[model samples]
Target chain A: MMYIIVLAFYLLFTIWSSVKSLKNTESISDFTTGGHRMGLLLGIGTTTATWVSVASVLGVPGYLYSSGVAAIIGWVAGWCLGGALIPLVAYKIRRPETPVRTFPEFIHLRYEPYKQNSPLRMIVGILMTIGYFLLVHIQVVGFGIVFETITGIDYKIAIFAFLIFLLFTSIGGFWSVAATDTLNTVLIVIGVVLGSGAVLAATGGLQNIVDTLSTTTAPTIAGGPPLEQGILLSPLGTFSLSALISIFISNSLGSPASPHWVTRMLAPKNIKVAILQIMGTIGVLLFIMGPLIILGLGAKALLPSLPAGKTTDYIVPLIIQDYAPPLVGAMTLVALCAAAVSTANSMLLTAGTTLYYDVYLGIFSKKVSDKDFNKRLRLIIFVLGFLAVISAIKPPWFLAMGFVYVYGGFGAAFFLAVFLGLYWKRMNAAGAYAGILIGSVGYVVSKAMGASNPFLIAAGISLIGVILAVYTTKKPPIEAYEPYFEEKVSKSTDRVLSSVINRSEGA
Target chain B: MVTALLIWLGTMIFSFVLGTYLCMRIEKSGVKRWGATGKIFKYK
Candidate 1:
């Protein structure tokens, strides 16, 4: 009964949320980016929510419990790359000129400097958007598992609750998700922090946990991973030679190319805030993600007698259900739901907006009157919501925890194309295209063909291909240029988000 | 005890719905002159 009521709370809130987005306008920018007036905080929330996803909470920790610290390092490597490294390598990505409403939007602008056909942009955009939704669908499915497990609710009802609650975000795009994230992030911090403490206490304090694992002697969990990927014994060993080399050159080359992160860069209040997003994101990983790794190890001791190689991804919820007093149990459940909803809402709106604005309005129809565009956008969002629910009913092949494969495939391939290509004039479309193609092919094929560590192989192929293509291409002269990636704007209509970018501010 | 939980839950639902509405209102006002397509309401 309590679970049913909790489900009702989320559903009702989500459904009423989108009533306002019914008549949103019909331009590609309008659909893909909520017309991009996102403030700094909202922008951070959008990037964080989408990046965190259900994979972090459910999949990675359990993998860590069994596989050791290697998995945790593997997951954070991309987040660190995407969040921290992008601002440095892709600093010009934060420049003031372009209406970079999405990653594809950047590709469209940057690639057009060489005047290539839209086919490249379209192919990359469509492939990435599909990959994005696939990631979201896995999360929705995972949430369903949690809901059913806690509430004894039917899977169908659970999915219905998940879809309907998340659908509100689609109506107004980031406005609702951002609003909810303010609340959701606060809830998650409290939940994770307290639950971690309780579980730590429930199992006998932190030192007891330390003694139980004997990881003190076993592995450092702190150091830069070793050549053979062994845990280092000393304090200065965190930056293993392999890790420094791999991270500087080849991080995040195989993950899902998050189209939304780049979109939020243009949405920041100032370039400095764009810099802050890097810090905020890494801070979350260090604080939030770091704690999760510790909690999983704690659970290993608490539930040591249960099983030998079973996925302990279910352990967190099991602990809450069995030990937590009702309110704590309810809040723990809410935190998981909050995380799921934040990601779902962002993905649904992004998919709908991308579908409507980028695919439909840009190519098929032109001059979509504001009224028709908004109506269609709402309709598309509703359809996506239903489709996600339908997709959720069928179990996801990628475990919510196992998204590294897809993230690695898409993130690695796409980030290389966008970041390196945008900054280096020498990087041609052929190089960008080759980077994605080789990386995705290398990673996915390596896995399907039975290779160990498919991720590293995919990234290596992508990096080498892009490097070769760039060097082989003719070098455009190093010269002073425009302050931004200036899109061909219809001077008649001002780009709302682009206008906010103050040129006087760019470094 | 049950009543307190119900009230807390009800308050959250109502506030989120209300808060979302207010935020959307401010957004429309802020983006009004900037050629916001949000105004073109076919659904209305």
Candidate 2:
């Protein structure tokens, strides 16, 4: 009863925020990026909320409960390094003069500005659409777990129910997503912090938790073999040193190349706000991760092992149900829901925007009016959300570990291209294409061959591809690279890029 | 145990501070090439 009531109030708040945001969402710019005027507080809120997906909420805790200290090094420290690397991109990407609606559009302008329908843009849009679609599916799978636990509804029905909120929030686009994310960030912090405090109290403290971890021979989850005693406290718990290093590199290096993070960087008002937003988000996320570490380690001491048939994913909800006070449990579960929805809506929006704006408008028809485009974009998001719900009902085995594959692939594909495009004056469309194609293909093949670090290898291949292609191809026109490298672009260059720069000029 | 925890917490703070400083340098330096170019349009 308490869980249902809490969820109901949270749902009501999100719906209210979504409907309210609709008034300000007039153009495609407004729909896609909140008119590129997102302030620092809202920027930090949405970025943090979006960054802390169901993966971070559920998966991170589960990983820690199972694997121990290595999970912290791989995920927490790795992602922090990724956050640190983003400012390099943010400084160039968020120029007030070069406003962009989507990551594909940004790529289009940076590399192939002269072409009407660049294949580079199309390729990026297609990849983003596919990646985000899978991300939405992952979030829905998470929602199924939480909703089923609370409502006793069947998993399929609970997931379908999730689509209603996903559509409602996403239909309002960036403003609605950002607004709800702000509120969700607060909830996540409160829930995690309070839950951590309760877990620490229940386990008697950090010392006890650490001691138990160092001494226990308990299996991480139900029906699993027991780990070697003292392994949990080791630097490389269960994971070999090479595997640990690969996880670290994949998370840190691969994260900066992700389109969603790049899109968030573009939404902020200016370069300073963009840079500060990344810094602020890193700080807040560090705070959140601290409590989660406590919750995961402490839960081990509190519940030495889960019951039969329960996965490590059950650890969090189990801790809430068995150990914490009723109010804290309710709030923490709600926070998990918040994390799922926040990420789902953002991914849905990204996929839809790529399809509607980049693929549809950029390729087949370039003459869409603002009104018609907005309507069509909402429809695309609705359809995509519907598809995600259906897919989650029975996820394919291939999609099980897609988070790592997608992140590493994205890193390999876009790492060199994005960095060089920003700073290298001579990087041409050919180089960009080579980097994306070779990098993505290399990563996929390496993964197929079970390479220790596919991301690192693929990234290396991508660099060589980029270098060869850049040298062989004709240099990019002055107009193409000037806006990114120069604070003051030439008058002619500005005139050439006017159509690309201020996309919402006459809308 | 303490070392791992310290590494985790310490790395996060150091990364943020380093990232911020780099961004400040970029902002402070601005872009130098465009100054020599004639008839340029400055962005805010």
Candidate 3:
């Protein structure tokens, strides 16, 4: 009953937000970053929503169940380091580039300022779209899977429901999504805290859990792998720490490349990002990592019969079934829906923005005004939402579970290309193009060849692209991009431009 | 009962109070510039 009431109230609140955004939001900045008038709470809320996903919800639980605390440390570390990096990245992103809206726009401004067709950037944009598309698809499928597990609904129906629920999002794209996400994050936190409390209480409290573990009188089975790996929560972990290390590097740099992360730049928080990072760290720790730990503890107690390599990935739902009443169970399901929707919203916006701003404007639609862009953006959102629903009818479990494929393909292609493009002015566009092409092709080839770790294979190919970029052509001299990619990173930030905060979008 | 009592006591006096105090302080001053009705609630 509590869950149902909360969700019903949540729906009403979201409707109110959508109405509010429709009235106020008119231009691109208004749509993209709440017209740059967003306070810190909304900024932190979007950051939390971006940072938490099935990666924490289902991935960490399954990982803990299978491997122990070891596997989780690999993935969660990226988010932790990002807490420190977000300020520096946000500070760099907040200004001068305020006019520069999208991630691809940043690339176009910084590297290809000559404003000519560079095969490399087109490749960069296309490869990233492919990567982000897969990410969007995976989140939609994740919603289907968990909703299926929790509600006993068919997977097809579950996908349709998630898509329909998301159709309630603001028509202005990123603006509506961010506003909705900020409000929704409140419930996500509530569900995590309450769910954790219930599970801990039902399992006879922390003392009882500790006692249960200590009293497991069964002697060790020699030479056999530990039972925790079944849950992906083992002590040392399963995958090579190499996999862990690469994932961290790939994600930290890769995040800034995603248009989703860059859009937050437009919304200037009152606290500047330095403090927001610490708060963001708290948000992820509480909303994401904290729950995984709770779920881990619950799985250790609730599902003792979990077999080798088959830890309870569905730990939270099972606990809800055993612990909470019907309404709470249903509402927590909404929280899961929110997590997946928040993730999908960002990915969909990234792909649509890339298509419209990067590819369409000045080409298909020549006289592109701010008004025209708004119309195109809404059309893209509805079309993308429809495609996601259609594709998620039957999702591959491996991809839906969040590992290996998209991470490897786009992870290798974009991270290396974007970092090189930004930091290395001498980087030839050809090399950047070759890198993305080789990296994406390597992903397909590895899968075709039945390689064990296709992601690593793609990473190797990306490295080959970098080497080619270096050796095949001479680096563009420093003067080539000096006008745009400045040598000294600035410290004097938006405080000088404080007056421009509210007026940036219109004036 | 003893452990629970001690844990509850320590939490109430320390983490809970400190966290609230710090949060309130930040909202009042740290984000006064953002200017949201009266106090900004310091979450930034």
Candidate 4:
């Protein structure tokens, strides 16, 4: 009965927010970038909410429960560093005088300056769609797990419920996503932080948590992998230093390349707001990671054993069900739903926009009317969202691993194209094409060969490819470089001219 | 145990501070100045 009430409340809140957003949204620009007038507060809220997906809230804690502090060092620290780096590039992204609706569109404009109808744009569009689809699939799986845990519904039924809810919420576009994400950020902070406090109070304190985990031993089974004892207390635990460093690098660098995060960068009203958005995200991370760390360790200390075939991901939900107050548990479940929905909506929206703008419009029907295009975009969202739900029906081996794979792939393929292409003057389309092809292929081959640092290896190959391609090929025409370089000269001239005029007026 | 907690907290704090500082520096460093005016193309 309690679960039903909470679920009803959640549904009502979602519908209300969507309706509000839909009233404000009228065109593709509003749908994709929220009219590019988003202020610092909403920018921060949405970015933080989007960044902290189901993976951070549930999967990371579960990882901490099993493998210990290594998860925190590798995932949390790495993500913080990566998010911080966004401001360095955010200004350039938001500075472009022309509005870019999607990340792939930005890539096409930046790299294929001379070419009409660039294939690189289509390639990026497809890659982004696939990457975000995988991301949404994981979120659907998380939704299923949360629903099953809270409402005693079957996982399959829960996934369909998740799909129906997200389809309605996301139909309003970026306005709906930004508004709901901000609300979700608030709930997430309250639920996770208070829930952690409740757990700590129940388990005595931090010292008790340490004592409990220190004495606990991993269960041993015949013909199974050996379990390491006291891994919870050790810094590196069972992970090697190379593996830890690789995880850190992938997360830190890969985050900005995620299409959803790139879209967030594009939505801010100005460059300063974009920078503040990242800063706000960093601040939010500080609050979230501390509580999650406590929750994971506390769960391990409290629930030391599970039935056969169960995983650590179930530990947090189980703890809330068994120990937390009924109201608190329900709220936490709502927050978990919020986390999953915020990310899934953002991913689905990004995939739909990229496919519609970069692929369908760019390649096929350039003359489509605004009304027809909008309808097509809505149709694409439903189709893509449904496809993600279908794909998630059979959950994968590990939700977190899927995240790492997609993130690493995005980083290896697009990191140079974005980072260097924005800053480096000489990087041309050929160089970008070589880098993406080589980097992505190298990443896959290394992963297939079970390389220790596949992302690093792929990144190195991509970098080398860029250097060789740039030097061997003839330089692009000055027109190709005008937007990035000439813009600098023009802006400085304006500043100098304005300062001189102010001095004369003062005299 | 205390040491571990300190490390985790310290790293998170350091990263946040460092990121904020870099963002402000970049804003002031004239990187933002370059992109304010130029030929901007809207994707068709």
Give me the candidate number with maximum lDDT: 2
TM-score of 1: 0.75
What are the runs in model 3 whose C-alpha is more than 4 Å off? A1-5, A35-37, A86-88, A95-98, A116-118, A207-233, A238-253, A269-271, A274-284, A305-313, A326-331, A362-365, A398-404, A443-457, A467-507, B1-44
**iRMSD of all candidate structures:** 15.8, 6.1, 10.0, 7.0
- Write model 3 residue lDDT over A1-507, tens digit each, in one string: 454466567667777776676776677766666656666556668767766676566666655544445544444554454344444334334434333556665555444444444344455566656666777777777777677766677878878877655665636466677788876576667666666677687787766654544433221122344443232333334556565555554444445444555556556653243245344535445555666566655655665544333224565666676786666666666677677777777777777766665666523424445677677777876787778789777664543235445555555565555556545666766666666678778867976797656666776777777777767887654433342344232333222222222222222
TM-score of model 1's chain A:
0.80
Overall lDDT per candidate, in order of appearance:
0.56, 0.81, 0.57, 0.76
Clashes of each: 19, 0, 20, 0
Ranking by DockQ: 2, 4, 3, 1
Q: lDDT per residue, candidate 1, A1-507, as tens digits? A: 665566567556555554444344344445555555555566556566666666666665554444444444445544454454444422355453444666655665555433223556666667766766776787787788668767778868988877667767666655566666655665566666666777777878767765655433332222323222222212112344444334323335433245666666555543444544545555554555655665666665565532332244566676667766666667767777877878777777767766765566446535455556666777887887787788878774645334655555666567677666655666666677777788777867877896656657776788888788867875532211123333223432233334222211122
Query: lDDT of model 2 at residue A182?
Result: 95
Separate DockQ for every predicted complex: 0.02, 0.25, 0.07, 0.19
Assess every candidate by TM-score: 0.75, 0.94, 0.77, 0.90
Error of 1 at A142 (Å): 1.5
True contacts kept of 3: 0.06
Error of 4 at B8 (Å): 5.3
| lDDT score for candidate 4 against the true structure | 0.76
- What lDDT score is found at residue A505 in candidate 3? 28
Order of models, best TM-score first: 2, 4, 3, 1
Candidates ranked by lDDT? 2, 4, 3, 1
Clashes of 3: 20
Instruction: Report the lDDT tens digits of candidate 2 across residue range A1-507.
Output: 788889899999999999999888887788888888888899999999998887777777777888888778877887788888887787777653757778988888888877767789989999889889988998998888777765577889999989988988999989999999999999999989988999998998888998999999898766689889988888888888888888778878878888888888788776667777888898899668888888878888988888886666667777877888878888988888898999999999999999988887777746666777778889999999999999899755222135666778888988888888888999989999999999989998999999998999999988988999999989999988888776778887777676664443343
Q: Go through the candidates in order and give the C-alpha RMSD of each one to the true structure.
A: 11.4, 3.8, 7.8, 7.1
